[model samples]
Target: MASLNVGNLGEYLREQRRSAQLSLRQLADAAGVSNPYLSQIERGLRKPSAEVLQQVAKALRISAETLYVRAGILDEKERDELETRAVILADPSINERQKQVLLQIYESFRKENDFETLSHADADVDADVDGSGSDARPKQSPPSS
Candidate 1:
């Protein structure tokens, strides 16, 4: 992960929990975690695993990717997707539940596309993940002064 303001994630989490109108104990119960643990998470004293984050997102009726982005756990691909989610959340018209529904639909489509791509990977396409070798994408040339 790149550089991120990881400390502010607790404030963000606290704000989200409050926005959802859930008490600390309530969210902890909903996320199937202990109250003190959830409190610690909100205080930035601990980092939750992906599974726990997913559970918290479900309890908050929000995207797990949001939590992942906040915690600086996303890869380049997910970071790109996070930009879209941020746009959606920034829109003042949609409420939290609406945002959740939209995110769910969007995520389903992405998952479907990912499944299709993986299932139908071209046997002839032998590009390395690091963009090395015979692949033909344009490369930056040395700048002439």
Candidate 2:
């Protein structure tokens, strides 16, 4: 399995910034950082703190949680999500907007699958509660044999 790579965070950030049509200096100003500092961050030469990532995320009009995951500040089940997005963003096969579209579709599919799974699970639980599931309920004897 591929290990997590925070280096891709820089590229992802840069992609987000550009999609917003913000130049390096513009993003730096918006995020309250020096231009050189932001440049270093985008170049993957520097790792930004949580606060910095938050500020940058806010400036880009995106969720800070995404930045937190990318920065390795929020390591948990969220890592898979962020890493999947990072890989999508890094893929050269698709362009930026296409990547965004694909990500949205992927998320929707996951949600739909989860919903279906839960619905099935809930049906099973309901059946159990009602003792109506096959092999669960008591069988009756034949009458007038």
Candidate 3:
């Protein structure tokens, strides 16, 4: 019953195709999809599956994971993590060992944040169950007569 967010994916695909100097028909041929179907996808009249997106990404010489993220198949957090790892791995200044260490540290920090978020949520739930609202404001006494 809900509309899927495919418009952004379509726009992104069009942009990538254009940037690669390829026409809709050419891209469709390269991606092994029909021209009309690719056009429909670009117009947001169709939602392509992950395999289709992967084929398109290959035709465009782009990352399939990026397309997956734009197509809403992957979470934004996953994209962020992948991008961070890519940056770290691509940095020529860092040695391979250093890059591995940095990635390990980054992963640990992410896990720590996830744990803290869960702990805070649990605390809020406990506060609600105990008949004290989740708000942390201190209770105030009425003014004396």
Clashes of each: 0, 0, 0
Order the candidates by TM-score, highest first — what do you get? 3, 1, 2
As a whole number from 0 to 100, the lDDT of residue 24 in candidate 1 is 98
Expressed as tens digits, the lDDT of each residue in 1-103 for candidate 3 is 2345688888899999999999999999999999999988887778899999989999999998888888879988998899899999999998999999999
Measured on C-alpha atoms, candidate 1 has an lDDT of: 0.83
RMSD of each candidate relative to the true structure: 11.2, 11.8, 3.6
Give me the runs in candidate 3 sitting further than 4 Å from their true place: 1-5, 134-145
> Which lDDT tens digits does candidate 2 get at residues 2-117?
32356688999999999999999999999999999888888778888888998999999987877887787886567667778888999999999999999999899889988999
How high a TM-score does candidate 2 get? 0.50
Q: If the candidates were sorted by their lDDT against the true structure, best first, what order would they fall in?
A: 3, 2, 1
The lDDT leader among the candidates is 3
